[model samples]
Target: MTTFHAAEQGLAGLELMAKIREFERRMPLLSEEGLIRGSTHPSLGMEAVAVGVSLALRDDDAIASNHRGHAHTLAKGADFGRTMAEILGRADGYCHGKGGSMHIGVKELGVLGTNGIVGAGIGIATGAALASKMKGEDTVAVSYFGDGASNQGVLAEAFNLAAIWNLPVIFVLENNHYAQSAAIEDMVAQIDLSRRGEAYGVPSFSGDGMDLAEVYELASAAVARARAGEGPTFLVLDTYRYLGHMAGDTEIYRSADEVEAAKANDPIEKLLGQLIAEGAITADEWESMSARIVADVEAAEQFARRSPFPDPAEAFTDVYAKETQG
Candidate 1:
């Protein structure tokens, strides 16, 4: 067992950190290269929520995500090659050139998918959990959405449905303080988003989005509670997105200094610093990990570039059963 203590060397814990770092860095570069056609809302400063919530899921567990989902997809174990390829408009991608950057799916890896619609994944996760309960399966469901999506009435309705039926699901709200150009304080009636879950009689808690260990601890408890037939739990991960709503967001919304200041508390930097301080990882280890991640990401990018675009005819084919397609 990997103890959260310094004694365990915290190796597996580092992998989660490394994963987040790679995802955060590679996503923007892919977009800049004009490979990822759809808009990308990078979780630049909010790695902890994805890392924490993912630890709560198993191979059979399903996760549904919203627009800003690179962290969620990576944490859910989507193949970096295919994930990037999907973003790069390649046929070998998760959607096989169908669902681009904002819509990636790998069912075998437990990522049901990333939806473009706000608060849409909530219903999907709820329905999946209900199915698991009825089928007597141990599988649980997780839905990762932004604080911005909380304004959607569908989320409240999902909370009600999950609570009344005792479905095995976890709702992770990554509160990054903005909904496009609107600030969290400007839009929400109560900045305490957890209160919305409480209103539906669901037990809700907040977690530190920059601390993976803290996230893991909270998520573990939430997962166990839901699977034990205790019902759903709402988690508000306090974090921020360093990137704008998309790649070329205007500075009129916020100050450049604010972005730089937020990067100071970046989860990857904080994790690496702690690992070195605790002697769990040496300088060389950090260097080696960085090199490996860079090489891997570069290779995936090359693969995506070489991959062919999906055949236009194929889209009409997956639309129906074999008989219908034939």
Candidate 2:
């Protein structure tokens, strides 16, 4: 748990962060319990970026996400029970159980989609921004991808197009230090992903992704820029994830000591401590909130467990691959 300025900002931010933290914390257990099918990637230690950025936007603003995007969808106002049911492959999921964890999205909330393919959603978001601009809508489109996706050529193309056309888009890179097993430093010559956007004449900002306030401030500025017709802004968030690439990842790449060290700076824990110190929430209040969150998660779990699976006849219903012009 984290507590910096949690009391001063009121309880909404604290509540959102707590929900994200609890959601990520329980996902792995759900996988272990055989409740989630296929593979599920948990964003255990990177809740702040999702909550902060989501908080900075209006409900009508759109965002596209990467594989580890449950936090993003939830923070953006997607229903928890439906998301849980989706993860469990239930009929009530956002995609009616077709998307599983990696491809879930709630269109009503303005989440374009979560892409399992690396860097895929960047183009989708760029297109969304272009559409918004053409329609004279003030909506801002955001693409949330990991550090690995930053290396993809599609990202550069998206940035170039958005910059040339002055489209209202934001490219948010959640640089979590690892592209699954390999340390980021070993994989890329430049770890400062924000600088990559600077080459295309796009404004760039970098900050501590663990600090919710910092993330919110930067995201707010970027959102404002896009809404003002200032084109795209590239933001690189330096954050970390507590879990391995996937549920069954042996994590042979990193040591137990390293993970333990990172746990000391757990974002939610930091906020909780700050809130109490600032007299924002009493100890009892925090405990009560935690209890409510636990109950909510348990209820979602029950809903997911009891929900029926999708009908086999609907397997190919939503499947489509539209041809793109060259």
Candidate 3:
């Protein structure tokens, strides 16, 4: 497998990370305008983890995401316009506007779905990995969840199953310090989440999620191991979210100082600065890139706004599968 350090791949990853950031940054405004109806979780500061892990995988490798999943979905190669349309409840969405932001599943992209239920993706991804193994495919599956999900029993079960069956799966824990209003410390007895996978004999690793290079390096190793039939690996990515747990959150649990401190290590800026320092990209190129990303996001918004909503009669259609004629 090729590493993300290659010049072209690095630049592509940076651009994708920027696009994910810009896309989620526009969410609050859409929410305020009532364009997004439900609770939308923004993965503002966690772009590096998403892009890094995604860049390590092939298009056929599957991924299951949690509520704060826009980054994961987009990073996994979903269409920007359709993602925005889904959030806006438009008919052109991946789920025909029925699944909204939390339930986007693009089978063609191997993005199994972005679930609303906490820790649910663990089982889904594990099942996907099992299927791939049963089919004798080399593809691996990834499950993305937050620090809060670390405490869920499903994680332990998935770990055990993946280990015993030698299924190819990667469990990525984005430890962003807080689980909604509750801090990670208050929610779990073990602060170092990387050790959670050790009990089940799954090799675990931890890294700074803000550093895209570090994330990519670690994820590449994990992906390689899984593809080699070495069973599952768990990654504890220490990152933080700049936004609230969800839209309309008062954010009373964390201090303003804490938020500002986390913003200082903004992942997008971190990678951008590194690229400039290494002479890989000039400031002018970055400016141009940012402008193009912003324009793309705006166009997606317009597309979602112009697209029609799903018809009421269609709700019952996709719910059940119709029998095929023999």
Candidate 4:
């Protein structure tokens, strides 16, 4: 494994990873406290993948995400308070409280939105890439989905169109081993999901999703390739989710031992250790940074709690075009 020095990379990566961890750690509490009305899939253990891939993209690049996408949104520069508000269905949300946890999106930030369906966001990302090519823009679109989504036929369709048309897009498969409750081993004949891209003549890569630096390096290359009009790439990320599929899942599918083993290599903690070993930050400094992240997340939580819900009369405002004929 390569070591990272804070002097060369600055502390932004470490900070973002910590922030994401803190944000996810608090997500379960939000549900337990009844702050969130609906279900939410936490990206607790997969912060590195989201942060690394998002940090590799340009400001104008677009992204489509799965249900567990809070980290993706935040890493892409969305306001945490507004995202929290959206999850809480408050008026100050990114979607103006219309779209909840499963559909929070901010177009200004190039977030196409998160989808509840398994692989639906792949098509959205492909469509965004096509639009970018049509407009002659250099925007690259990324689709973040889970291993469970890899089986969906839409993914194959997206791969074919993107390859033939040479659209600027990237398909990031977060292979967390389980698709809801089903293990990926039982779902596919071949274990490697990246082969799907190879079949479509697209560049395919698989790497450790828990390593931030590795993910960023691979994602940067893929983003560069797509921006250069070389077509799309498929990146299979080996990651894990600490929590169950949803807030109230019984989690009878996996053992606690398995989850604990994954936690030993916690990406956030690994980054912090590297920073400390490099003398870029002291142990106390690391604690201070974590404390600040905690405060920031708490502030966002309070902001969501204090915000009012959307008014019922405004429901039909942004839904349709004004010029539509009856």
Candidate 5:
């Protein structure tokens, strides 16, 4: 059994890396053939955020992820097949094909929903934490957003409430260093994004989000503090997004050398290397795992492809959580 006590041990070294690679390899295909519509934010280089946070969270703990959130939903234990189907607008998807890639969630699984608006879900998580406090539940709520979201005024407001009320919430800033096309430096005057939380008096810390062990460690501390009623903790996850902002991005803003530089320290590669060195996985065994992941993703795509899209009329029904009209 994986003990949550040691945050490092919470993450499964080999298996987690395999999942990240699987998604990275398959996401391109999804876009190429038009299976996934709208903007799909590939968490290709930022797998550590999903895997690390999921490992640290209890089954009942809640989460709201960014628009680029496939890994976030899957990391929290949502069925991959269903998520893909949701992206494809199939009836079998997480939201009966209504939510699409931006709105993946299972309330029972404590995934509130990934919001399409930047930093909007921070408020959702804050609200969930308040509800938990009211119900006398110890469960914590987490919100995952990117550095770009730091610019949004709503985020600052959410942090203030979480701090003043001492709500059980963790705000994870997945700082991939780019807000759309511009780099983090150009986008914000303060590069240390975690410092933003200081205004709310929320204890804030940054971490190497590309490292599973590091992210797990930081998240465990944040979650524990929240559970102990110490209020919110803002965590800046220093990571990278391998793909462009969107599927059709020209990506000419940055040099190819910069991409190469980021890839040089690819999170998946680092994790796999560490596992191999530690004797947790051998070369041939690792190769087998890679092969299996590729096959599994392909099979999942096939399943999504075969699934039927929901009836067009159903779209109007699920758009809002409405009651009877007089």
Candidate 6:
């Protein structure tokens, strides 16, 4: 376990983790009230991977996210109000109410966008890395995908391309045990996902996604390797999502006891315990920080509610590039 000092990075990470948790917890409620229209995949138990990876990235480094990407966007320093507004389909969203839930993108923050397609972001991140290499820039691109996406053919192609070209990219596989409703054991012949990169000559690693410190350490090392022009690295983070695959899933695949067992390793609680044990933060301090975060999330929800939807004409706009006279 990495010793977490009472410093900016460690404490700030804890806060961000807490914020991600609070933000996702609100999604189901919003959906239930019909404030959110479509399916919202809440990453209820996977906050550590998002925050840890974001901590290792530079401001200019890019990330392409999978469907369950609210945590990834938030950890990448997106505006809380705007993220909520985007899900709410308000004009104030990152995509001006068009992208909604699965497609929010913030160019300034280097968040390419969240994809609804299972393995689409893998190719997108690879292309971004190729662009960076061509431009002679040191910026690395990260592709965040789930265990379900691991079966997609694009991952293999991206891995091969990135490895052969030596493009700086990190393939983060959030292996939450099940791919939607099917168990991972049933999907792949090889259970250990970390070794998936071996054939492509890309270095691979695996770690406890429920432990923020472990995740941070792993991500920091991977990011360092990429920044040093060492080419792509694959990370298999073993995590679990407390919620169903989407908002309305009955979750018949897993039982209540199974979920309760997984919750025993809750990431937020583990991190808080570590911080408190190290005397880096007091219990009261955490309480105050958590309360502030909850209040802020509440404020974001209100902002989303008050914001107006996009004009009907907006459907025709942003579809194609405007022609510029030569």
Clashes of each: 0, 13, 0, 0, 0, 0
Q: RMSD, model 6, all Cα superposed?
A: 1.7
* Residues 124-233, model 4: lDDT tens digits: 99999999999999999999999999999999999999999999999999989999899999999999888989999888999999988788888889888988889999
Q: Note the Cα lDDT for every prediction shown.
A: 0.81, 0.87, 0.91, 0.88, 0.83, 0.91
Superposed Cα deviation of residue 32, candidate 5 (Å): 2.3
Better of 1 and 4 by TM-score: 4
Candidate 4 contains a number of clashing pairs equal to 0
Cα lDDT tens digits for candidate 2, 21-140 = 777778878899998888889898898888888877899999999999899999999888899999889999999999899999788999988889999999999999999999999999
Candidate 6, 192: how far from true, in Å?
Answer: 0.5
| Candidate 1: tens digits of C-alpha lDDT, residues 1-326 | 22255334245556655766666667767777777786877777787778767766788899999888877888887777788788777898988877787888887887878989989999999999999999998888999888789999999899999999999999998888888888999996789999999999889998788787778878888888877888899999888887778776774799999989988887777777887898888989888977887788778777888899998778775454355553
Instruction: Give the residue spans of candidate 4 off by over 4 A.
Output: 1-5, 8-10, 321-326
Query: Which scores better on TM-score, 1 or 6?
Result: 6
Give the C-alpha miss distance for residue 281 in model 6, angstroms: 0.6
Pairs in steric clash, model 3: none
Give the deviation of candidate 5 from the true structure as CA RMSD: 2.8
Two-way TM-score contest, 1 vs 2, winner: 2
**Residue 195, model 5, lDDT:** 85
RMSD of each: 2.7, 3.7, 1.4, 2.6, 2.8, 1.7
Off by over 4 Å in 6: 1-6, 321-326
Point out where model 3 deviates above 4 Å: 1-3, 322-326
Model 5 worst lDDT window (10 residues)? 1-10
Q: In angstroms, how far off is 192's CA in candidate 3?
A: 1.0
